[model samples]
Target: MGDRQDAETFNNLLAAFGMARGKLQLPCVPALKARYVQKVIALANLLEKPLTSAQVEELETAIAQELAKGFQASQHSQLLISFQPNPKSVEQLDFKITCQIASLAEFYEAALKDNFATDSDQLDRLETSVFGKHANARVLDLLPELGDPETTTILDIGAGSGRNALPLARSGYAVDAIELADTFCQQLQQQAKTENLPLSIIQGNILDPLLRPKLNHYALAILSELLVHFRDADQARLALAKACDAVSKSGLVLFNIFLCRPDYQPTIADRQVAQVAQSFFLTPAELESVMDGLPLELVDRHSVFDYERDRLPSSAWPPSPWFINWATGRLLFDLEPPPISLQWLLCRRI
Candidate 1:
């Protein structure tokens, strides 16, 4: 009787342990897949028998390290999809893909909730390194020239986390944001209210006519890090046209896009095609063609290279220097409609 009781207890514990180590689906990216596999193996070993609190903590640390390595690898291996030059006129470029904005909202909710598991300082560091310092400063530099303090109302399209909007509002600009992510929109609103900053936030798609009409009243429209989500050229051009229409005469549209050199072609995962997430890379000439009919003038244009010094933290793999070089180097073309590169013409509406 004693032996049987012990056996039953052991079986129950084993079952519970298995349940604790849930199956993990590997990300499609190569580096992520490798990292996830490593984590699974480590976790399996840790769950093989009962562990003290310290031992469990140690295993957790090992898992985190593996994930961080993979994240770094993924960032290093990131590449922009390449665009092939087509003889067709820019207006003729296919632009029919429609995204389900709700899907994006769901993705944001999951991402934000998961981020809470990370340390605040670590998150801040990651944000600064990956997003805040490098690219945003370039965008912020143009704000002074993009609008006048008293006269202009600014529209920040694709205003994720309200990063740009928050600063603009604090600077006393009349700012409004259009964000597609539900959780991000909520967070933005909460932050704005908490900071006592004045900014209007609209949670909706840029393609929605009724919801986006608010954009037409603005003097300056900013589309930072937004255009790359466009999978089709026609769709992107239409969005651009709508943005142009939203601005008043002599109004400015400041935007940036990720483009690949003609020699480099992106794999399916790089373009997010496998997941049906929309994305596209633009060629220099192709971008210019899209801006032909817009009433805006070119102000200045240059290609900004985005380079990363470190790797991403979410990936579970080892870092590869060659992959990092390829992923971190990006050609950012800043344009004002009636197109140019880096910075473009400042055309006055006729």
Candidate 2:
């Protein structure tokens, strides 16, 4: 920030605030609704010099109190917000806060790092993290649908650390694993090599147009626990299009997606908020709209939690501590029946 011009930095901050609140979904968060959007202060005008440590804290408090007004009603929870600075540049912040309210800026800051990019340190923590802590219960249960591992080929897009892919390969199914994070790819590669599994690791983003896999080549494509990471329903749409392109005719695509209730109309801001909380959500209608013209047919959709719960033994009620919270939409809300939930969806190519 020291290197950036003040004006540029200020503009960026303003944009971040606007984005965090969301222009399209502002109504969902009443405090940040129409009038508030027009009233956000230009902090630049208030401060001519750099902020002192104490001043920053004061600002954060004041801001959090305001954001809390909306946050309390905005469906956000008091989950641990994490941050990891670059090992070289910024000093690491080793701190945690528990409070009645958290500012939108705090969430915005956290969202910036939530993406497990090449530079992010999340890869080192994925194993300890609840994500991919266990092979997706739905993916494991639905494996037989792919049929004849000896001859079937499977594509696991966004395959983090080979959670599902490794198990499939070990079962003798030829697997192609695509991942966006370098460390995750390397982790999967090392494990695959150790067992000499038939899994091929590809380091790429499924969203990249140039990262094309063979068209109509795979018997099945598994995208379990991945779509919610996409920026919006549109990005999910693109990935599904790619999945449709990769699976052969009559082949299938199975994905675990977080979806809002059909009757629930989430504002764009609501979706943005969901993403910041480590979940990206879409409506069933939006999903149908995505696969509308594709050569894909929706075969079935089941509640992920219900399927896994009814199958896994009582002792293994939740595969991980965060599994129930995340899979049932508690990550975004504390409701008994969260308006959103994870769903196991399967589609077949025409």
Best by TM-score: 2
Best by lDDT: 2
Q: Write the per-residue lDDT of candidate 1 for residues 88-167, one digit (tens) a residue.
A: 42211111111112244565455544653255444333322223433354456666666566566888888876657877
What clash count does candidate 1 reach? 26
C-alpha lDDT (0 to 100) for residue 91 of candidate 1: 14
Candidate 2 residue 15 C-alpha distance from true site, Å: 36
lDDT by residue (254-298, candidate 2, tens digit) is 887888887777776667567656578878788778778989888
TM per prediction: 0.55, 0.65
- For model 2 the local lDDT of residue 286 reads 82
Residue 27 lDDT in candidate 2: 20
Segments in model 2 whose C-alpha atoms lie over 4 Å from true places:
1-134, 313-317
